[model samples]
Every structure is written in structure tokens, then in C-alpha cells.
Target: MKKDLIYSLPVLLATACSDDAEPQSNNIQCIHPGEDLQAYYDLLTQNPQVVAAMNLCERPASFQTLLWDKVREAEKTGLPPDAPKPQSYYDFGLEMETKSLSGVSFDSNQYQKIEMVENAEYDFYFPAKDGEGRKLIISNQVLERATETFLRNQEEREPIKTIYTTKEEAQEIYAAHLAHSLWIEKNEKVPWSIIDYNSEQLGELFGTRTWFKTWDEKNDEYVISLVLDHSPRETWKVINDIVDLEDLTDQKAGVRGSAGYRYSE
Candidate 1:
């Protein structure tokens, strides 16, 4: 399904007890991938919620140090055998041109230029339309082309830096890295579908809906439920029966897996 769909689940909170304590809610706060980074960073310095979610003290320097330490650890151990590889960053830029029609005093001719900022590579162009109010449309077309080109080019690059190691460390880094990267990548048009659905697809192809859900940072693995709303129980059984057959097939031929679970009533 969609990453937004998985992210929409209710945040589960852990509770504590005390003799004179007020009732505590278990709502664990989470930061959306699209939230403003500077604001988030600043909030991390001031907000208890952000600090708790990141499992850090309310000090930015401390958090940075912790992250750097993890990076060094990953570099030393290498990523886990099954961890997804890291991606690279790409920058995008846009340019636009417009011309008024001759004698007609009407807007007509328009052109747009879009390129990757890093390599100065031109990727797309937009031309004007023919209509009574063509000038207005052409202007919009130019802006839209520029925006679209930027988004497309941005999608071609990886959203974060990653290193491989053991499954345990990989899991931790994956969760932490994804949490941060998701925020940075939101609305930037990078690949979200790839990170969220590969595992689910693999499960479906194998006809098995049950799989292990391991946190990227922790050793805990939970049994998660996976099924399309329209999927049948017999189909699931078939997948379960042939789960081992995956190794016999081309490793790269199947869909990737995701990290969350879903249930339907």
C-alpha cells in the first residue's frame, strides 16, 4: 500500500506508574517525513516529544554525536546481509522563457528549461499552447514544467547516506535513518513506494502473508499480518507452502518487502 497509509496508524504509547501520578497516555509522538527539518531540529532542542521520539536528550549536539557514532559503527561492521543499500542525493534547477505574440499583443510563445543542478543536465522543455488566453496558460505551463522537471530529477537520486552491517545494526540504522530521511524526503519526489512495499510484494508472490517484522535498531521481531483486502485464505496457504521456493528462483525477480503490518476488518 502507500507509505502514508502505514504512517497513519495510531501511535502506541508506553505507560508508567506512580503513587501520586496522573493518568499517562501511551501516545508516542512521531515526526512526519515531510516536517520542516530546521523547525524539527529546533524543536528537538525545546520539545520533549521530539526528543523522546528520537531517544535523545534535548540537546542537538548530543543527538548529532550519537548519529555520527552510529555511522562510524556501520562503517566498521558493514551493513547487514539483507539490508537495503544506501542511495545518493541529486539537486535540480529550472529556467523559463516567455514571448508575446506579434502585432496581436497576445501572449503565445513560451519555453521552459529544466536541468539537474549538480551536472547541469537538461532534462525537459515546455512549449506554448494555442488559445484565446494562450499567454496565461503558457505562463502556467512554464512554471508547471519547471516544477515537474525538478521533481522528476530529484526522484532519480537517493534520499540519504547508508552503510551496511549485521541485521541487528542494520535494523536499528534502517529505522533511525528512515525516520530522519523520510522527513527530509517528504514532498521531494524521491522513491517512497520502493522502501514501503517490496516486502509485501515478495510475500504476496510467495502466497504467504505472515513474515517477521524486525525493527532496524532492535533484535525484536514480531509476526505481522499482510493481505490485500480481496486476497483469499487459500492463496495465502499456497504462498506459505512454497515460501522456500524463492531461493530457487532468481533473487532479483520478486517484489521488495516493507517494514509495517496491516489489518482489515
Candidate 2:
């Protein structure tokens, strides 16, 4: 009964929220990880629960304090049993990459106050498709952990070594790689008779990924990078490897991967 209840909870919650209620009309958004770190950081600074979540019952440290006290953890000391992991305090990227790409869950109105920044001055920098800006949908758990380290800065009053992605720079980065990239459009519909996307094809497996990572720099130490999330590769794959719908049912099923990135400060 417990197992059944647990299994049915996700479906129940999803069903309760969707089918009838218009998700789009309700100002409900799926915020992607790292979409607006600064804004989220501000929220973290103000929210006591979020601050306590990060502090984990220890002396509050700077945001740069990446990892947690593992030795203390082993000794069952310092942090309480429920503290978040260090990597958890940064980004959902590693989990997204490692976790099986089966479900496409997204963060909704739970963290709704994550303020977005847009201006006419940067109008020229906007991408051709969405002239306004971009939006990402992250999970609640991911958002909770991701903000801990960032919010620490507020408690410690640490200097913000923020690297704003400039319009010209953003435009330049977009043009250099993704401007002509194949994953910009939606893929053909997936067939219903599919099996598994990670089936072994000798050494290389088959799957659907709409995101990629690209390093950017002016040949210097200070380099700003962006992780083209799942939306970017909607059109195709890394090599634009679009499988035939008929072929999908045979061996290579659908393993859909989303895009995310690491914003180093």
C-alpha cells in the first residue's frame, strides 16, 4: 500500500494540476537552473528557511565555501542529518547529466519571485527566435539546493564577483556556435511503440539530447560560459542525429536530455 501510494503520488499531483487548469494562463513558469542566479540569491538572502537550509546548523560561511564538512558528517557531528550536499548547493547540472533521462519534470510557480532582467539597451543582443529573452523550468529540489551557496554571500556580506553576460558578448557567443546549430528546432514526433533510448549499440548508445556545453573566452583567465539547455537542441542532436520515427521503435528508443550549465564566478 505504501509503495503503491508513493508511486501514485506523482501521477496524482500531476493530474490534479493539469488537464483542466491552464498552466500557461496562470503565470506558471518552469524556471531552468541558473536562469537567474542573482535574483534567486536575493530571495535566499531574505528568506530565513532558505538561509537555515544552507547554513545546516554550522557557522555560516562564504558562498565560495563549496563543499560541506564530510569528516564531521562521518563522525555524525556539526551539520544535522538533513543538510544538503555541496554540489547540490551549486547546480542541478551533474544530476541532469547522470540521472536517467526518462521524465521531463520542471520547476513551476514554487519559486515564482525569481526576478527576470530585461532592458531596451540590450534589445540588439536578444536572440532572433525569442526577441524578449529565455526561460527555463527547474525542479523545486534543485532550486532549493542550488540557492544555498549563492545565498551564503548575503549572510557573509561577501563581495559579488558577478560576471554579467553582456549583450554584445552574448550575441557574439550565440553567433559563433549555436546560430547555425541544428538543435534549434523541434524534432519529429516520437513513435508510441518505442522501448529504451540507452540500448547498447556496440559502444555508443542512441538518445535525444537538446542541450550542449561550449567553452567561451578571449584567451584569458576570465571566461564566461553558457550551457545551451534542452530547449536549444529542440531541433536536433550534437551532430543533428535525428533518428527515423520507424527506427525508434526497433532499437534506439527515446532518451530525452535537457540542457543546463555551470556559471563560474
Candidate 3:
């Protein structure tokens, strides 16, 4: 007969935090000043390794130069003339807004193109804030995929496999054994001396208790039994009352539960 197995593993638990950061509003925004912009551009240009990492090439470079020209013009006039700016320019400006608030500053109305690459992933470009010539780009592609793959592999490697067997079988076995055990615990009240003694002997006899053989021909009757351990008189009475012995002899037609029991013809 085909059977399904069900098992459980320990679950991880966490305590809720008493305090958490409040969410920020979306509509309100800030911009950077001109001197801060120049400082940001100077820092990126100074870091050759950072530049190479972002994959900044001719077009991005030329665009960045134009942005610098625009920044210089903004400095001269203290205002920017309306013109078509590269997407990179807006992206970098947003980044600068965030970074500048965090102690980083850049020139306003200038543009700088930076590429960010990490872990063999495609590079992304960010333009400086408000057409500032300094942008922050990060190579996030590789890192994201690597983290996902690691989690997937970890789950695949777990040792325990949860099984869903036939529900009828599980219910029968659980009811039978549970009733028997409860009866013994309630009625006998065996002295600690006898109880302890019996436990050692029984523990050795039954390594672990699992569902017993089923007898129901149509639905597969199941019962639970202690391995090598005889049931006490009271316990046996409860088992006898709950379990149908005749059902144990018949073959079960189907299995149920989450892991789904297998049936062989």
C-alpha cells in the first residue's frame, strides 16, 4: 500500500519591536547649493576606481561635461535656463538630494554621469540633483540576484520534508492513541516510583510511536500503538472503545492530508 508521511520542524519566532521609524511624506523635497555640487563632482572625478566601476564612457562623459557647463552657467546667472536635460541628470539630482541631506553636497544645475556596477550586474546611471554635475550610480544587479539565489538554495537544502498523508489515517491514529494516553494519565495516577520505572523500560521498548497499520478496506482504518509497550488496562479500555479492530484488517482505498498519501492498485 502507498502511504504519505507528515512531519514538522521547529519554527522561528521573533519579538515585535516596541518602536519603529516613522514614514516620511512624499510631496515635500529639497535641492542642493552650487558649491556643494562642485565638491560632489570633484570627488567623483578624483576617484578613478569609482569611475571605472560605474562604466561611464564617451556619451555619458560628454553629457557630464555639458552638465558641468550648465552648472558654470547657473553659477554665473544664479538661475538655470530651461533646456532638454538627460534622464541621467534628473536621477543624479534625486540622489544628491538624499546624499546632501546626509552631509554630502554638490553643485546645482550642473550634471555629472556616474555608472554603478556590482557583482556582474548591469550598471545604472544617476544624474546630479537639479542638473548638478555629480550623480551617484550603483551596480546593484549582481548583488540582488546573488542574494535571491542564496536564499533559494538554502531552502532547497533543508533536511526535513513536510509530508501530507491521508487525513482519515492520521485522525484515526491520533484519536486512538490520544484517548489511551489520556485514560492512563487520568485514572492510574501511577506512583512516581512505578511510573519512572515503567518509563525507562517503555522508552527502550518503543523508540518512537507512529501510526499503526490500517484495516478499513474502503477508507483505511488507522490506530496508534506504543512500540513494544503494552497498554495499561484503563488505557486499553479507551483504545478498545475508540478504535474499530475489524477495520485494521481491511486495506484502505485512499490516503489524505497535505503531503497527499499515495495509493497503489
Question: Highest lDDT: which candidate?
Answer: 1
How well is each residue in 34-69 modelled by candidate 1, as lDDT tens digits? 222334333333333333333332112333343433
Q: In model 3, how large is the Cα lDDT of residue 149?
A: 47
Query: If both were scored by TM-score, which would come out higher, candidate 1 or candidate 3?
Result: 1
Compared with the true structure, all predictions reach lDDT values of 0.30, 0.26, 0.29
Which residues of candidate 2, in runs, are more than 4 Å off? 1-15, 18-188, 193-226, 230-242, 250-252, 256-265
**Model 1, backbone clash pairs (residues 3+ apart or across chains), number:** 20
lDDT of 3 at 208: 21
Ranking by lDDT: 1, 3, 2
The residue-by-residue lDDT of candidate 2 on 1-265, one tens digit each, is: 2111111112323333333223433322211113222233233233323223222112112111211122122123321112222232123223433321111122342323332122112111111122234455444454444445334533377432222343333333232222122111112234431122121320121111111122233332222323323222233333234344455552234443212112211
Candidate 1 C-alpha RMSD relative to the actual structure: 21.0
List model 3 lDDT by residue over 22-110, tens digit each: 21222211111134344533433343222222222211223333334444443454432223322222222223332111111233334
Please estimate how well model 3 matches the true structure, expressed as its whole-model Cα lDDT. Answer: 0.29
The deviation in Å at residue 150 for candidate 3 is 58
User: Candidate 1: which stretches are off by over 4 Å?
Assistant: 1-40, 57-168, 175-182, 185-212, 215-265
Worst 10 residues of 3 by lDDT: 9-18
